[model samples]
Target: MSYARIGKGRNLPEQLEDDLRKAIVSGELAEGQALPTEPDLAQRYGVSRSVVRDAVRLLIAKGLVEIRRGKGTFVRAARGEAFAEALLLALARNGGTALDIEEFYGLLLPGIAALSAERASSGDRDRMLLRAEAYLEAFGREALDPSSDGPGLLRALFEAFMNEILKACDNKLVELVGGLLVRMRSFRDLAPEEGAREGGVAAIIELEERAIMGLARAVAGGKASEARAFAVRLCELRPSLRARLASTPAGDMPKLSFDMLAPIVQDS
Candidate 1:
């Protein structure tokens, strides 16, 4: 694998790490490919085996490689679980509430929708429309049985639709952030505000579903700004939704993690 021509400024280990990292990120060192033996790397880089080991250790900590003891050190796909946990913990420790996450996601959704509109292929657009319709249908069934986990099911379908949009956006970091935000909380978590009427709740839910359909249509039609505007319109309904769903019983929501995230995970 090739790295940039060496400059003699950094410490030995750091320099080696930088070159190896470049190689891996540039796909010169392919994923799941084993690295050369320590002595071989040492000889190739004109460094001692100890320096090579230190560099490899650095790569391991960066999630760029895995050691299999008797097997060898191979490149690994990076996962965001540790990053997500650390970030979520940091938010909690810093006194960030669920509303903070909600607002954060509200700000992110428009861009995501716009990106989906701009980037999605015809097949992706078709899937986006299908998922959006599924979510709308699920939401309509929420009032059919309050005792059932209808709200939870609706939430799942909504997440699945958004996951499709996120995937269509073709950005891994954006997808991860959006996924984390959705998991932070839902409308069911909001306190039931007094004077929330059934009529008002139904109206708000209808409006929200319409916005979802609009977003999907905009994406399918390649109307980026229209998709973004639909997303913003959806966000605007949140305050009303908080009041509307205030009377929704906790029992109406899912009690455990079941198949809610299965769609996204399965596709991944």
Candidate 2:
């Protein structure tokens, strides 16, 4: 397993956690395997026991491993699943503005798209294409409201993307980001006028089609970098859309607040 390259003057705990996490995700440390004791890990990593403890705590908080009482820390069998839920909850509670979410999507969506392109089965590609067509259809008629189907279409896209890596990444951090992206769509608001201007919901479908097709081709061709780049371009669209919406009249805007979103994930 390749440890995260640590630059000079990097924080100890952060570096240690990065290395340990990479090791776990790379299968250097198998699931259900006991990690070395704090003292041993500290000595092996050339850090103080305190630093090792902090790193362990960081991993625990991410739901990566469990420190059993009187036993060593054990890799979680369902770490990725647990992390996804936790991340979604966190984003629902704390994710601000369309811009903030857009930035995250910029970082994640393209990579997922690329991965889907490279690794998606025929069934997966078909599913994405079908969803893209539905999304396009949803925006077609004048009577068809963009606000009504916009969120749902976006949700579908997110779900399709989620299926690509929900099992493969096996890293809590990656899963958390995926869950956050999925949950963030709930906060999006599409005013009628804005939707019409951007090709009346059809544009979104078109965009998805392009993204999915690009991803499919990239993945099928084993072009991981190309797939990732396509996703990054798609991610840029959110901020662009947000900017356009922000410039329009205020009366069309929906009344939403962070307080209103808190309860959705309070229990989780």
Q: Could you tell me which 10 consecutive residues in candidate 2 have the lowest summed lDDT?
A: 259-268
TM-scores, all models, native as reference: 0.62, 0.45
Give candidate 2 misplaced runs (Cα > 4 Å): 1-96, 116-118, 121-126, 139-150, 165-173, 187-189, 198-208, 238-268
CA shift of 241, model 1, Å = 8.4
lDDT of 1 by residue, 11-93 (tens): 88889898899998898899899999998888888877888899999988777899998999999975555466677778767
Candidate 2 collision pairs: 110-231, 114-227, 117-215, 117-219, 118-219
Q: Considering every candidate listed, which one attains the maximal lDDT?
A: 1
Residue 161's C-alpha lDDT in candidate 1?
Answer: 81
Q: How big is the positional error of residue 241 in model 2, measured in Å on the Cα after superposition? A: 3.6
The alpha-carbon lDDT assigned to residue 117 of candidate 1 equals: 92
Q: Which stretches of candidate 1 lie over 4 Å from their true place?
A: 1-11, 46-50, 68-70, 78-97, 136-159, 167-208, 237-268
